[model samples]
Target: MTSASEPDGRRQGASAVADVLKALIREVPDFPEPGIQFKDLTPVLADRHGLAVITAAMAEIAEGADLVAGIDARGFLLGGAVAHRLGIGVLAVRKGGKLPPPVHSETYTLEYGTATLEIPADGIDLAGRRVVIIDDVLATGGTLAAARSLLAASGAEVPAAAVVLELPGLGGREKVAPLQVTSLQTV
Candidate 1:
């Protein structure tokens, strides 16, 4: 149960883990677009120790959540790992058109354009369930914010969100204000 604290008293957890992430996270310039440097977590996720540290930290942040909602792609990996660590089920928030009809969807603006996220409208009882959204990175925050809204509309309570990395200059924190966000590292 390793935990670290931010200057604001928010528990970030395990400086050693942060160090590992910082070391392992690969930075590529001009990815997906010009003037955008991408921080790829593939290496980090592939490393056994890196995965363990992140899973533990994220699980701690999502301690009280009944379910973990992972965003469309990369988030699925972290969400599954954290949910497993916490002994909770994971809800896959899919991309638009990925799931069959009768889906709960929310569209949001991305840095480039726009995208939509969806979850099953039926089969899963979201009413009154507590959820924690997990993702690999928090950039513009459009994806996470839309996921939160989608979950809330379905009657699920989103108490908090966790991510491995946060790009503060993007204003994601301000955009998702009022929702507690825990990030293992900020760049």
Candidate 2:
């Protein structure tokens, strides 16, 4: 329902979301290590319009999904907001060890090491469900890929993924090849 209008009377979903993020995203050089310019989205998510615009846009991209699988950390924010707006349930795909036993886990490589993502295996029946993976940023796509694999293992159909920001230079999009990724903004 939240869309940005252009002079041509057309809606610019990604452009509108990008405009909001460009105004609020914080940039930090050499974060977590040297030569890394970190795009901190704290300010963006904190702002009312920023959050609303992104949530609405992502919800549109995740249309037709029966369930929303929010990746660990920031993904939870948008996932919950979108799912609520769409009147759907949000499944928390937490970090490794965050959930109790009987969780489906998928491991992926990071820049320095490896990380794991998990979801409750017994409580939820993901089989035959259409799921959309939501996350705050798509940097390298490892997390997104892992989430897709984890969800698919549960017999869910991961048709697509949505993210607030994408660092294209990092090859995140290419890393998740075959998985359509809709990003609100790229910087």
Candidate 3:
């Protein structure tokens, strides 16, 4: 049961969170490779207030999700925070070779190369679970698309994905067509 005022409060909170992200997120050019600008969210995640605001906003978007699957590395931080806020479990979608044998995996192409993501096939029961994928940024869409497929192959229903930032120019949205994506901010 929520009051009408609750929505207003959340809206205001989300706006504030967006401001925090925009202020703290760093833009570094020629990172990892030439002619590429990378958006670093490490500062935001390290800030106490920033973490609370972003986590709350992400949790709001993940309301109906039964489970939260976070991409390897940075996604793990955001996913863990959002899952904790929602009182749900956070599944770490690990990088290839990080997990032991008997795992579900998917590989996708990156701008520079190809990478694989994986999850345990034996320990967790993903069948019939409603999941929301969380990540720091949506770039090529390959990572996200692969993650969604991996989840589906394990019998999970991924209704939506939440990201802190999205590079629409990269055509990730189009790449993962049919999958609703919610981005806090676009760059």
- TM-score winner among the candidates? 2
Find the 10 residues in a row with the least total lDDT in model 2.
Answer: 1-10
Better of 1 and 2 by lDDT: 1
lDDT of 3 by residue, 67-152 (tens): 99999998999999899988999999999999999999898888778899999999899999999999989887999999999999
- TM-score ranking from best to worst? 2, 1, 3
Tens digit per residue, CA lDDT, model 1, 38-157: 999999999887887788788888998999999878889989988987799999999999999799999999866899999998899999999999998888888889999999999999
Mark the regions of model 2 whose C-alpha exceeds 4 Å error after superposition: 1-12
- State each model's CA lDDT, in order: 0.88, 0.87, 0.87
Every model's TM-score: 0.91, 0.92, 0.91
TM-score of 3: 0.91
Model 3: worst 10 consecutive residues (lDDT sum): 1-10
lDDT of model 2 at position 100: 92
CA error at residue 148 for candidate 1, angstroms:
0.4
Q: lDDT of model 3 at residue 140?
A: 79
Q: Residue-wise lDDT of candidate 2 within 1-187, one digit each (tens)?
A: 2454342335666556677888999999999689988899899888887777777788888889999999879999889988997899999999999999989899999988999999998989999999999998898889999999999999999999998888898898898899999887777
What lDDT score is found at residue 154 in candidate 3?
Answer: 98
